[model samples]
Target: MHELSICQSIVDSILEELSALDPKPKRLISARIVVGEFRQIVPDFMKEAYKAVTKGTDVEGSELEVKTAPIQGKCGDCGWAGDLPMGDFKCQSCGSSGLKLDGGMSLYLDNLEIEK
Candidate 1:
């Protein structure tokens, strides 16, 4: 699944970041992440991906915790703001298809638990 690649990227970036630490971490315990609903990520799939990709690596056995945010949109013309259904970008109240997505398009590792 595509989540495998995403998890792999996370591991790679985290390794890069950890290299900057004054004393390198000995083992990774968990990774906390914020994934937006607009990204269409399945949490179960992502967890599976993390398990598979972390095998034989320093991050093996690390837990993946994901927090999801809603797909929010803001109407430019009528100032309407609320959650929007995926694939339907139109403004709910104004019915004006002119809406801008304010958030909910992110997938990033927020924090990591590690042991020295």
Candidate 2:
């Protein structure tokens, strides 16, 4: 699954950051990531992927915390902008279906909890 590759990338970044530190951490407790709803990433699958990818590494025992970002959009018809309910693309204020989605497509590592 693509989750495996995604986790691999995150782990790579973590290792790179850890190696750059003057005193590398003894252990990684957690990795917090934000995933937009539009990405359709399943949290369980991502966690499983992280566990598999980190096996036998310095981050093996770390937990992956996933935060879901809501889909946001702007209505072209009425110039309304706000968070849109998942799967509902209509503008809440104007009842128009011409909502231009501008958010919920991001995926990034947000924080890392490490024991020095």
Candidate 3:
């Protein structure tokens, strides 16, 4: 699935960053990632893909810590700001349909733990 490609991208980015290190890292220990709910990335599947791609590589066996951020919404009618349920943007207050999605649509690497 797309997770494979995503994992590949993660590996490429990790490698790129590692290459820039002054005393290059000997291995990666962990990777902290943030995947928004809107992205619909399955943590288990992504982890499997990462393990598969990292097999026999320097990052192999490294842990992946995924943090989830809720989808936030802002009501255009009542100016209410809060978390919103996935797939729908109904405002909690005033029951207004004019709700604008705020965040929770990102997938990025937060931090990486490396060994020297």
Candidate 4:
């Protein structure tokens, strides 16, 4: 699944960042990730992928916390700004399809807890 590749990328980044530290962490404790609704990433699948990928790594047994952000957009025609359902870019107030997405469709590591 794509989640496997995504987890691998996350692990690679974590390792690279850890190596750059002055002393480097002995082990990773947990990780916090922010995912937008538009990203469509299944949290359970991601957790499973992470567990499988991290199996023999320093981050093994580490907790993964995922936070989801709502999809936000602004209507270009009526200046309506608010949350919207995923994939529905239409403005609720003005019934306009001309909308500008402001948030969602984002995935990023928020924080890492490590032990020295």
Candidate 5:
């Protein structure tokens, strides 16, 4: 699955960050990632992929905490700004279909806890 590749990228990034530390961390404790609702990521699959990819690595028993952000949008016609339910992009205030998605398409690492 693509989750494996994603996890590999995460590990690579973590290692790169760790290398930059004055005194490299002894081990990785956890990583917090913010994933937007619009991203089609399966948490279970991600966790499984992480476990597999991190085997025998410094981050081997580390935890991955995923935080999700809801889809937010603004209606171009009505100027309504709010969260949009899945598959329902129409504006709730004026029933306008012209919406501009402003959020919920991000995926990035937010925080990391490590042992020094």
Candidate 6:
């Protein structure tokens, strides 16, 4: 699963940043991430991946907090714009298929909780 690689990347990035700090953190508490619905990431899989990838690493024992991000879309037909329901590409106002979607495709670390 790609979650493993994603977890590895997160760990690598966190460790790199932690190393640059003047006062290193005593413990990593959690890594909060936003998982867009459009990305179709399984939270369970992500947690499992994090557990596997973090073993023996500096961030080991840290939790992975996942948050779901809604998909936003604009209807070209009705000029409507708002957050769209997942998998529903049509506009709620006009029910048009001419919807331009944004967001909900991202996978990024939102923040890190560390004990200093």
27-79 per-residue lDDT for model 5 (tens digits)? 88998888788887888888888888889987889998888888988989878
lDDT of 3 by residue, 1-116 (tens): 88889889887887787788888888889998888888888999989888899888777899878888889888888899999888777998888998888568878888999888
Q: Comparing 5 and 6 by lDDT, which wins? A: 6
- Candidate 1 TM-score versus the reference: 0.85
Off by over 4 Å in 3: none
Which of the predicted structures, 1 or 3, would earn the higher TM-score when compared with the native?
3
TM-score between model 3 and native: 0.90
- Runs with alpha carbons beyond 4 Å of true place in candidate 5: none
Model 2: per-residue Cα lDDT over 4-63, one tens digit each = 888899999888887888787788899899999999899999999998999998788899
**Candidate 1 worst ten-residue window by lDDT:** 13-22
- C-alpha displacement of 1 in model 5, angstroms? 2.3
Model 5 worst lDDT run, 10 consecutive residues: 1-10
Name the best candidate (by lDDT). Answer: 2
- lDDT per residue for candidate 4 within 18-73, as digits (tens), equals 78887878888998888888878899999998888889987789988888988898
Each model's total of backbone clashes: 0, 0, 0, 0, 0, 0
Model 6, residue 38: C-alpha shift (Å): 1.0
Give lDDT per model, in order: 0.85, 0.89, 0.85, 0.86, 0.85, 0.87
In terms of TM-score, the best-performing candidate is 6
Q: Which regions of candidate 4 fall more than 4 Å away from where they truly are?
A: none
lDDT of 2: 0.89
How many backbone clashes can be found in candidate 5?
A: 0
Please give the RMSD of candidate 2 to the true structure. Answer: 1.4
Residue 60 displacement in candidate 2 (angstroms): 0.8
